[model samples]
Target: MAGTIALPLEEFIASLDNASLPKILQVCSGVYFQGSVYEISGSEVCFSTGDLIKVIRIELLSVSCEDVRKNDKFELPINHTGLFKVVPDEMPYSSIEELLSLRPVGLESSLPFTFSSHSKMTFGTLTLGPGRALTVLSIERHKGEEDQVRCHVKGQQEASAEVRIPLSSRGEFYECGSEECFTLQEIMSSPSLRSRRFHFINTTKYEQPLVLSPVYQVHAIMNLRKNVLKFPSNLEVDVVDVTEQCKDADFVNPLSLTEVLSQPDESFPAVVEILECPETRSLFKCSWLPELNKNQHLVFHKKGTTAMVLLSSLKSRKTQQYFLVSQQYGGRLRRRPREFNSVYELYAASTRTPGLKVSVTRNCEEVEEEGLPALSVGDQLEIVSCTRMELLCESSKGNKQSVEALLCQHLSDPNDVDDDDDDDDDGDEEVKEQDEKTEVLLPLYMQGHFVEILSDNKKYRLSDLEKEFSLPLDVKVVSRDTGLELDPLVGAACLRIEASMLEPTIQASFPHRPDYCFEIPTQWLSLSVSFTKHPLPWPQGQPPKCNIERVTEVTDVFFYEFRIRGNTDEAPPPRPPKRDLSSLSVTKKSSKSEKKSSKTSKAKNKQKSVPTDQFSALTLNNKKRPPAPPPPDGLNDEPPPLAPRKLSEAETATRKAQPNTYVKMEQSIKNDLYDMSADVDSDHDYESMDESLVSMVKTAQEHIVFY
Candidate 1:
């Protein structure tokens, strides 16, 4: 693979060793030289090739072949060796002779070398490297007149192996050059080298002058097998189908098959984003046809300009009318290299299939009724005028005849029609004939016509006109050209539907009032109530009474006498269905009902316990009551009933007596504890006194005559 070697001028020069003394190197810029580096000075590098001496600045010697391994295998340097194809350059060549006259020029010498041509083709064997060479056969053509006569390398075959070459001017002249064209712009600026081909010739001596043979001409060559430098190269563009994930890309709106045919002239924004490698490149803005099954072609163009055009069409089977259009961006030019403005337009007719006409505009105007030009599918027409008309004539015939016929009909004669079955058959036949005559001869008019209806807008039908006139209408033919309203009947008049109905009156019941309205009916209003604990001695007065405040009333407070029906019961008004309460219950329904009953009983007991109009003070005593004995064993199973809140006078006295007995028992226990403590103190004192008397007697006897 051929590639680019980019490094500092000094480092590339430093990679050279004794064995790699004879090497081809390039300067950074400002000078062109492809010679062996003879000597390296502090600020200069010298190059020579027998009678040729080129001294380059140290800074200018930027690019060099540093690959110096003797045993390393090297493939073709695709970038340097013009062994690739040559495509039509932006510069146009008119004839085959002009294109074939192109010659390869050296960067340093600007020396021109022409290819040896035979049978209108330049055939040469390219020596790729040592023991590796291929024959390059190319031809020039004056095809595609836009950029005429392109140079193309037809093919490459092993030089040692025999391969046949066709001499005829036919088949595809492989497209090249546009993408494979190589230049030495990176290393040098002046005396640029560009060739139509390249061949490598291995020389043992550095001073040997490079020459070409009658079979092969050297465009440019690098001995990669003996260089330490490896250049980066681009792989050939591989055309593959877009991945299944990208088949329906999320970013781009592809043209559907129906849209391609129906909306041929419409231009849709072509935006596609590849989510897989999103950061690598910006959005791909290119036109696409959804109807085309082929995926987008991805080209990796490292250098130069590229342009792509795709044409797609759809045709009608019966009419042979089609929508032919080509979508593409302008090819890259010096002024606009990467153009984003893609152009697409429908063709007047299909060039591929004869007799196929393409329609660009969708609006088809009437030629007969509007007195416009007759237009075929591909005819171009411009809008003259557009206006709104309440009534549009449907039939091509004149409108005056239809209006006159309507006015002649007698609307009052329907009541006198025959009711007999025998006459019905005759009447039907007469009605059918009259209908056919009116349809075939007179112009039919559409009274109501509009794309959209806005507020306060109105449309009227024929039925409305009949209803306005009670008797049969007697219209005198009025000329719109003269701007006259002529009617023969005395009470006859013309009136618009909007004029007759000043304001629309709907017959349905009133809708719910808006939230902003304060006068919303009481039934429409939602009321909520909350209860709070009242303070003690709450507004002491004669009696507590509930009061109702009259906030607002629509009518004067009217006192109406009501006669209640004693036999019938008024049905309750419907209520909104309540939310399910089953989830709220912790226990089963049976247990829940028992709990509710118990709560209700407790509420009743509490109400009865308190005096309705009086306050009862609570008094607590400090005396402790005697602990009650444990309930009998079997009685423990049943819980004791709660005592009444208010106790009778006798029961209260008895309860009070129970506390007195407990106090007495407590006092007796304290007296017995005191008596025991006194007896223990008296015994302890008597023992001590007795011990003291004995000690005193012992001391007196011991002092007298114990000796």
Candidate 2:
């Protein structure tokens, strides 16, 4: 989302630097320990942390730190000297007496500190603990005070040797404990600067000098003539180059968005190609002046100027004033800089209290004049009288004015009257009573299905159900079937329209879509309704109706009853008993047996109804076997197992005795057995002799034997 805005590259970099550096410093400040320098090179400086020496690159200081200075130096006790960072507002002091009397409250380091011209010398008071502080100072001098010094040395022979000390060393400048003095430039340039002996601890606290990389060197170009710095002049060129490289990119100027909005009728929308700032870095919205060459460097007028003005004379107000500053640029009122002001303002001529300017921007025009008072809803006001054109009103403090001049005013209620002048207070009581009776109807979410049966007998189902249910049943069912409807589902109930009601006066919101509202009539399609709650007072002789809305999201599949305000007077419909597998299986098997018995009965009925003459000759065939036909005509019944007659002669005798009727019956029995096994859920063997089909086959075989 941030990529959608066309922010300048420097602005983006500045934002990143502001966000990242503070977080890094916060984290480092908590854990950074005092360390001594171990090594220094062109790229990085390594500092010893007792256990390890961490190397910090010189490039990091310029990239992260905003205030970077160069060639500044400081000193410490025990003859230690090194270069230190300098603050932006550093000043030079020549007298130590002025430094000792200075307070350190507003200083960045919260300590007594001073620096010489160009920050060449820095004096600091380090508070090690209560009552224990170290005062260290540094100085820069070109020439040494002493001229030439002579020293005499004698070599030791047998007994003793004597050495002569210089008399110039005891001069006035070498008195007290401050005897030693060295030129600052000489000390900072010596070999001892790289000896790793001095601990320049406070250098990291101040503004470290910048080491500019090639790409970032453009930022170093600032206005040096005014002892100040501004944004780089070539920034506009870089922006144009980048835009040309990415021609398809969106060109949105966040600063000039308001300008674009103000100029809607222009042929082409205005786009800000460059953003310039002064040395203070106070950015403002600006545009290029006319008739300027491409590379001639155009100057801009101060865009918007804001000021904090105070109004000291307005009545009954204590808050300060804020103004939206506009400037007269090129003889026209142009918009001001897009800076935020925290003052709360009504932006009306009536609200401001006119007074002297508390603090004004360099040149800003006041947009609103001051005279009128802001009127609110509950304020008290007295109406004087109405003229031919406008009405007049007076304030409580006796301020009189025309009502037209006021920005806002409240109208007095018609029922209100002066209590001191009125004899009776009955009107007020009547007004209060009317207010109490005025009821606002809210939406009611309801869902319900028709009640089918009153008794718990499974004999009743949806087929015998009524279209609607009401508290009183005998009332002529005003609803008619109209030959337009059919019975509902097997056991489900239909919507009971006759028992439901809706409010006539109030509009009900749609259950599925709360946004859609409509007024429900007192009676629709001549449906009957009865309310169990208290009777509603009717206005203008209108009948009372139900105030309800149905939640269609609650489908009719589940039996739902609306319960409101902890009232559970009506219970939900009872659920049917669930069928167990054992009972289901038993019933299924019994049904099959009953079907078989019915089939048998049907066959018996057919046999009894058949003409006797059709099968009169078959009666003898059906009779019990006449002693096996007298042993097949005198041959012994078993004829001593007469040589198995030729297979064809035996088949002929059997076919002649029993005709195709018996053959058909046997084939039917076999088919029935196969079908019975196939109809079961699991695998079954029809060949195995067992229940109904097996018994039927055995009976048929016995009948064949008898024949």
Candidate 3:
């Protein structure tokens, strides 16, 4: 065999110097130099061959995610596609290029609105965007335009109730930068939505196809940020699936394919494209459809500017767009260098050697990390991701027995090590064999674990935050400690997740011990529960009650643990499912039934000891039981078992069949996890501490998923 071979899982892992890959991808060249308005002031940017710059590109790799829509008072108009995606008629839906940036000339509202120099404006979503508050959209001034535009406005939330209008009827707003734009001053003064819609006119011209969310759409508008001409070298995605868009990427035989095509060949030579990989500069004849016209759309994203720039080559010229690159900073013109030497140092460094692996990770689950409320088993955690993770375990052909043995390790009773990386060496061995020689191992992070809300000063935690999320998660402290208050972390947890990370080697049977606190400081206000599955939908009109129970389990090994914090005065509130428009999103809510359907039962069958309930009656045996229906969204727990409000015969039919409709639209993709059992635990009654932890792990499993 001439091809490379994969080593056994143990041997591969053991051979590594470091188990983890690098966080930063290869340093790149062709940096799009940036000019700052305030920071650089009079400075200028100049690009030179071989020069280097750092950039950050924000990339989202998810195929789908859940969004919630809260109905103000009515149920039908609940805006469930997520406020971010809603581009009301007031502001037409736009790409980041057109919706949210502002220019430095300062709001010269006096000038007439005309196309001239690149015009930048600010776009802030009124309580709708996903980021803290808003986003800024800017328009690059076209070559022949003149005039500054000013926008006075009202806040960007729903117009007053008077604006009684369905989004579809309203259509899209004009794509004018200011004619239909808003300013902080104006936004705060807009009229009622009902009156606004009723009085406002409707036009059919702007109706464009409702497209799926763009791969990268600026979510919110924050501040009057200038545009960035460059992009960071890497676009982050926790997982990726770049399965060669071409049939024979490396086998570029133009003549061979052309000859076949001329003589009745099936290779479809017309589809072959001679294109360059932006990251890897080598020419690749890919399988991309010729109609894509990717080459014409010259877009470059640089780190400094939190926006993507159009590297539009002058249309007048025949060369590829951006055939020549330049740099500019702060308005002052940096003199261009005389020599056109090769910019190959960093460029060549980015080229990949065979077998090299590079990738990025992100936390997409609604699960909590720090202030998330701890979860008990019986809770289902569904973490969906589009990451393409590879299993480097030994091949069944050669190490079938060893692979089985390795899997068994996860099931063994707790063999706890003191620190979080107790098995660092062991795990590293597997990674060593897997990662490439030059791969940078970015820091590995854990996301989506549930945690009890400690306090609620609103932590809009995006490891990398922007202005859109700039909702004043501001601070206001009335500290009793008077003197030594740190960053005044509002919803700060007294005990952090990292603290227990590598806690002293937990003894056997306590791998997932629960750390309980009976009483806590009153400073923590919002006792919000966070889910790695869905933004917790705990019922409202109630506080929380700590119902701590400990149980022993059959398995001696430990898996995970949670620290529960609760208030005795509060009672567990009722939970209602949040609505999601299935046509647009996969509803987040599924029932926690007292019974199991054939499918849930099939998955449940593996757990021989699970307690059965009314749902079990529906569980079918073999013969491909009609695919069990999916659970319903917006479902209320059969309204308090006792004196439950009975449903009418018609209402009952609607409830039962709705879920099956949803399941047809969505399918969960399974990731080959190292310890599949740990993420899933049964919420069975336990005898002691060991059982409680085991059960927690099992419950955690429902939420656990590998990306």
lDDT of 2 by residue, 570-624 (tens): 5332222223456568889999999999999998777556534323433446654
RMSD of every candidate to native, in Å, equals 42.4, 34.0, 41.9
Tell me each candidate's TM-score: 0.13, 0.16, 0.12
2 or 3, greater by TM-score: 2
After the best TM-score superposition of candidate 2, give how far the Cα of residue 440 lies from its true spot, in angstroms. Answer: 9.8
Candidate 3 lDDT, tens digit per residue, 416-520? 323566557777545544431222111012222221111234432222122322211112212222221222222221211111111111011110111210111
Poorest stretch of ten by lDDT in candidate 3? 402-411
* lDDT tens readout by residue for model 1, 1-707: 11134343333433323343233333323222344332222223332221111111122212222222332223322134322223333354343334334433331232111222322332356312222212233332345532222222223462243322333423222212332323333223322122222222343322221111111111111222111112211111111112232323222222222222233222211111111111211111112112112222111101111111111111224221111111111111111001111001011111211222122222334433322222223222111121222222434233411121100111122333456766478776687456433311111121111111112223322234334432111121122211112211112122111111111110111112111111111121221111112221223332222111101111111101011211237433222222225533544676889999999999877855643211111112324433433332223355433333567898988785332222333334344434444666454321122334334433433333211
Top candidate on TM-score is 2
Q: Please rank every candidate by lDDT, starting with the best.
A: 2, 1, 3
What is the overall TM-score of model 1 with all chains considered together? 0.13
Prediction 2 global C-alpha lDDT: 0.26
Runs in model 3 deviating more than 4 A are 1-106, 109-178, 183-186, 189-520, 523-707
Of 1 and 3, which scores higher on lDDT? Answer: 1
